[model samples]
Target: MTIGIEYLRVVRERFAVLKGQGDKTFAQLDEEHFHWTMNDESNSIAILIQHISGNMVSRWTDFLTADGEKPDRNRDGEFKMKRMSKAELLDCWEHGWRVFLNALESLNEHDLVKTVHIRGQAHSVIDAIERQMAHYAAHIGQIMFIGKQIKGEEWANLSIPKGGSDAYLQRMLKEK
Candidate 1:
């Protein structure tokens, strides 16, 4: 594969891994846990979902042609506490990822060198993708942290569990 194609493929895989981690974290939490906050100032998983979804839609829709911070996006509103069912929250999450993934899928190797604007600032497509990847990964980390805090001892491991690294390594070797 060309470097650009390889890069796109790897970027999609990385994003899938991050999304999978978020999915595992969500699966471990109850509906009420989505709203749990460490303090009045901190955002809950619900807020994070709203913000991430809003961001994804804004940044990915018309990704190559328009500014990433869309004129219609209410970025601040995404942070406001809103009571939503687990299903609703998941729906929002799915929508965002769908838009993002679809946009990525639509890109060709030639698009990688093209310029895109985010908040009126110029960026190459590669830079734009990397920027959003970091953003989503950070939010997913927050979601996982909150889930782990709420579940405590009951939380299932998303990766190699504690004291299982050796076993995990052996298993990986066997697969190879």
Candidate 2:
């Protein structure tokens, strides 16, 4: 495959991995736990979801034709604490991901070299994609950290457990 095709495939795989981590974290949390916060200034999982979803929608819709930051986006409002049911939160999450993944799927090799705008700043399509990938990954990390903090000892391991590296390696070898 060409480099552009390979890059796109790799980017999609990385995004899928990030989303899987988020899904696992969400599964381990109760509705109430989604609102848990470290302090008044800190964001809860719900707030993070709101912010991430809002960002995804704004940045991905008309990704190449229009500026990434939509005119109607309430970037500041996303950080405000709002009480939403777990179902509502998940719906919001799904909507954002749908828009984002669709946009990513629609790109072609030629489009990679095209320019896009975010907040009036110019970026090549590849650079724009990398920017969003980094942004989403950072937020996902925050979600995972918050989930782990609330679940504490009850949190299911997302990757190898503290001392399971040898066993995990052995299992992989066996599979091979």
Candidate 3:
């Protein structure tokens, strides 16, 4: 496959994997669990989700023509504590990802080299995408960590469960 197509495929797969990981974690959490945090200064899962959605919208809307950091973005507001229903939170999350993934999926090889501004700084489109991917992955890890913290013994294994490495490795080898 050509370089652009390969990159696109890889990016799409990575995004899907991240989403699946988040989905599994989220399913194991309730509204109370989502709002729990380690301390007053810490971000609850709800806050994190809000922040991610806000960041995604700012960074992905008008991704090529306009600045990634939109003038109207209220980044600080994303972290404020709120009593959002699970459905509302999920809807916002889906909207953000739709905006982001749609922008990403529409790009071609030529678009990869085009200048995209993020807060007035110019970046190649691929670089901007990579930046957002890294940002999202970090937050997803936080979400998983918080989920695991809350569920403790009840937490669903999002990856290879602890002490199951030998079985996991063997299973992978068999698949290969």
Q: What's model 2's lDDT at 134?
A: 94
Which stretches in model 2 have alpha-carbon errors above 4 Å? none
Error of 1 at 35 (Å): 0.5
Q: Pick the candidate with the highest TM-score.
A: 1
Cα displacement (angstroms), candidate 1, residue 116, comes to 0.2
TM-score-best of 1 and 2: 1
Instruction: Encode model 1's per-residue lDDT on 1-176: one tens digit a residue.
Output: 89999999999999999999999999998999999999999999999999999999999999999999999999999999999999999999999999999999999999999999999999999999999999999999999989999999999989889999999999999999
How does residue 27 of candidate 3 score in lDDT? 94
Clashes of each: 0, 0, 0
Off by over 4 Å in 3: none
Better of 1 and 3 by TM-score: 1
- TM-score of candidate 2 against the unseen true structure: 0.97
**Among all windows of ten consecutive residues in candidate 1, which has the lowest summed lDDT?**
153-162
Q: Each model's TM-score?
A: 0.98, 0.97, 0.97
> Model 1 residue 160 lDDT?
85
